[model samples]
Target: MDVELFKDGKRLDGRDVEDLRKPLKLEVGVLQKANGSAYMEWGKNKILAGVFGPKEAIPKHLANPERGVIRCIYTMSTFAGLEDHGRMGPNRRSIEISKVMREALENVVMLEKFPSTIIEVYVIVLQSEGGTRVSSLTAAAAALMDAGIPMKEPIAAVAAGKAGGKVILDLNKDEDNYGEADVPMAFTKSGDIVLFQMDGKLSKEELETAIDYGWKGTEKLFELQRKAFEEEYSEPLDKKLRMVE
Candidate 1:
């Protein structure tokens, strides 16, 4: 399939090269059984994340006496893709993503407060257009906050890439396949980098540009994350009932 990534300073999707897709929605406390849960929709991607534990670590040998262990599982649903359904269960790719996600979140969680315990985060992608990893990370952070996990601050993530030899913000599926480079990054609310990964080739200057665009994207996403939490907790029982009525 041929796609025109950039033309007249605008992407094929009619967005400016550095403009991100909007209406990024985040919903918290979506699961009743889980300690904390969040659902996120970014562009064409749909993700759900749940947080469990901070309870005693199972298989005690894995327990950290000095701090709690953070375990993350990132999985894509069989029907998540646009074409053929993805295979069910954890694959090598999923395992690697999970490991990276764990590392990204570990820096912010106050694990020392729950030594010998475990904090489990599960992210499931129900649909994907691109940037599922970053979207999942954002959702996971929201779920962690919903669970009242002690943390320095919530983290947000975004993807930036070079398409048509120009740096673009938040590449969608088409741009991702055709782009020369893709950089995914996660940062704390204070703008501290917690996760950074690059795929494809890029010059030093291009890579730096992509990272700068990623930071811009994350800043916007952080606003949505904060709003999600505020809305989740702000509604009074009576107000909620009134809305339902």
Candidate 2:
């Protein structure tokens, strides 16, 4: 809303407008009953993802004996934000996002190993600060791992935005609202892009720069995911050793 007022290219959180909010907390196996579950928060954006199966397919029409099907359901909670109208049932946006997410994840998961089973990924947005899709993707990967699904590798996502003619790493709500362009991508640890999408317009040079920025951001984000998983499993063992001592 106030694009002209963002002087010195500074954001509300003191980030250089090109800086991304490092993921705050990432947890896996958060939902005890689910086959796999994860919750992650990036700045004010919060997301939760759960995975069920590699089990029998629910809708037989979508099933195939040669590969496992990826079923994704994307929904934002009623309290996701004040601006998001509370409406039940799947919307066009959710359906589109679900399709994108499914494609992104299918590339890495060893779906053929399951054969005819279904892997259902459900993403729930608890808060929407911006970059919700990227946040959801990160959570989905973590949840899939927690469920012990066979995956070629874990994946992470990052958003690159253009502000003041400079490509930035991540744009929060305010910057995104008025920024010139936004690009979000999901990548594997091996530096492969599994999903890519963008909005707004940009020059070829700027687009290349944004893509570079997004890749760099993803590297750092992957480390955060790994650390979180380590910490979750490490803490209990450390406490048990301390008790024995």
Candidate 3:
């Protein structure tokens, strides 16, 4: 952990403190059977998200007579972080992540449309380097849109932290591991902060600095989500030009 993470305001990977990783890719409607699906590759992280139901809420009790429910399950393949401490099945970390992810998604969905139903979202991490939650959130939002779910708008995810004694944006695995503080967040187009979580330690100023970076990064991330949807829904230049989404 003593290794220097930054040199002259640039990370070891040669990225500026506020820059997002390059070669990010996203695909929507990747699964045929699922109502909606998306695949996202961000940095070294590979994540897949699928949406199901809106049919009926299982067990009845989890359903609300007045509205629908959102059930999210976030899991990592055993090999995803196996080299670092991945578990065989759902553990405390996975359970907690699922809860928080569900809350973030619920903020943008119009649950009232499917009364007494459940919209199930599953996000699986096939690989990891860091920032998996944010990546998962980005993919899940696209999958929901692919499923034609009613939504207020799309949201994006970004993370920032204090690493190498400097506040940096979009942390990688190494920085997240060795950094003094980490904050992952989700944001809406209206600038509403839907998801926020902090790990490690930071002073008030450091926290604010990290969050500011996160907000800035989210602006671009949200566009990536939209781009995925547009590509998937866009018709070939032959028949109908483009579908209004």
- Superposition TM-score, candidate 1 onto the true structure: 0.93
**lDDT by candidate, in order shown:** 0.88, 0.84, 0.88
How well does candidate 1 score on lDDT at residue 166? 89
Model 3: per-residue Cα lDDT at residue 145: 90
Per-prediction TM-score to the true structure, in the order listed: 0.93, 0.92, 0.92
Query: What are the per-residue Cα lDDT tens digits for candidate 1 across 65-171?
Result: 99999989999999999787557789888999999899999999999899999999999999999999999999999999988899998899998888888888898
Per-residue CA lDDT of candidate 2, range 1-245, in tens?
Answer: 54552556565577774567854678887786678888999989899999999899978887888999999998988889758556846988888999999999999999999888899999999988888899899999989988889999989998887866677878887667788888889899898999899888889999888888888888878887898789778865321122233
Better of 2 and 3 by lDDT: 3
- Among all windows of 10 consecutive residues in model 1, the one with the lowest summed lDDT is 236-245
The parts of candidate 3 lying over 4 Å away from their true place are 82-88, 235-245
Runs of candidate 2 with Cα error greater than 4 angstroms are 237-245
- With candidate 2 superimposed using the best TM-score fit, by how many Å does residue 74's alpha carbon deviate from the native? 0.9
Put down candidate 3 lDDT per residue, 1-112, tens digits, no spaces.
Answer: 3879988768989999999986789988888678888999998899999999788888888889888999999999888973865465788988998998899988999998
